[model samples]
Target: MGFINDLAAKFTFRPGRGRKEQNGLLAEELAALAKKIERLAREQYKANILAEQSISMIHEQRAGLREEIRAGAIRELAMGLAGDLLPIIDGILACLDFAGENESLRAGLRSVLDRAEVALARYGITPIEALGGKFNPSLHNAVEVVEVSDLPPEIVLKEITRGYRLGEAVIRYSEVAVSKSQTGTVWPGME
Candidate 1:
């Protein structure tokens, strides 16, 4: 009996409501469902666009990191190669000091040295200023201390071999003689 009543209720309509009213209620429900579907589609589209923007940002950051790594590697390689080449360059300079009575040989060697300098110059390699200047532990390596009464202590007396730098970085320190007083104290009238 209970099942029969439930089945009758489903098939029957209200006392006053006709087919038109029932159809109106169904149409309202369909419109609400369609609106919900459209809203959800718009939200999904926005999410996809945000994801694409994030992916591109990540790609740009990765490219920047790669470029930084490459630049660092090249800097290290240039420093190492300069280390090996410096000894040879110093040797050539030493030979030039004793290149007397061989004018042609000396001139040829000078030209070769100049070319080598030009090649390294392309990479921003340059000689450090050492002689007749104040001594700096960062740029100058004190190979010998000269005892003098006239010059101020810590002043560079001589440069034994030239130093080199790449930009602000010291590739090699200048071998130099720094001044010191005979009594191992600060010079008189010198600050």
Candidate 2:
């Protein structure tokens, strides 16, 4: 009977005792809910940080691609412009070549050529000097060599083809006739 009574007491509730027990259960449930809320807040903060980082990385990649595209376009335009100017340079050189055999028209052709050169100069183009100057393998290609007693050796005696430059870049090398030493001894350096 005592065992039976203890069992009954475990299931049975006194009025005040039952109310306090129910309130304690509610408090425990609320504490558990607060812990879940804190975990959700931490997760939200991490997701926001990751999203910001991803946005920043994408922005940097887009900027780099844009800069590369701009540079490539600029390079292509510059190359095309240079190709177009090559034909003009060739035409001027051809005129100079034909002028050599015609003495009567040479002066008039020279005036026209000079005007063209001046116009090119206005746009940053110029001809390289070859005749009677020191031999520079960088800007002059020797097609023939002549031995002259009066002229200094290694001097440019004639220009076969005119060479040109744009800014500091050489477009063509001048085909020239360079002089060799006549006496078989190296000529003294020129003054």
Q: Largest TM-score belongs to which candidate? A: 1
Q: lDDT by residue for model 1 over 1-191, one digit each (tens)?
A: 67447645654777778898877876776687689779999999999999999999999999999999998988877887787788888888778878998999899889988887777777778888998999999999999999998877889997888899998898889999999877856665755
> How high is each candidate's TM-score?
0.64, 0.51
With a 3 Å backbone cut-off (N, CA, C), the pairs that clash in candidate 2 are none
For model 2, the stretches where C-alpha displacement exceeds 4 angstroms are 1-104, 183-186, 189-191
| lDDT by residue (tens digit), candidate 2, 1-191 | 67446545654665666777866865776687689779999999999999999999999999999999986775555445545664665676577677777876777767777776786666566789998899999999999999888777888998877777767777678889999877766555532
Model 1 residue 125 CA deviation (Å) reads 0.9
Cα miss at 182, model 2 (Å)?
Answer: 2.5
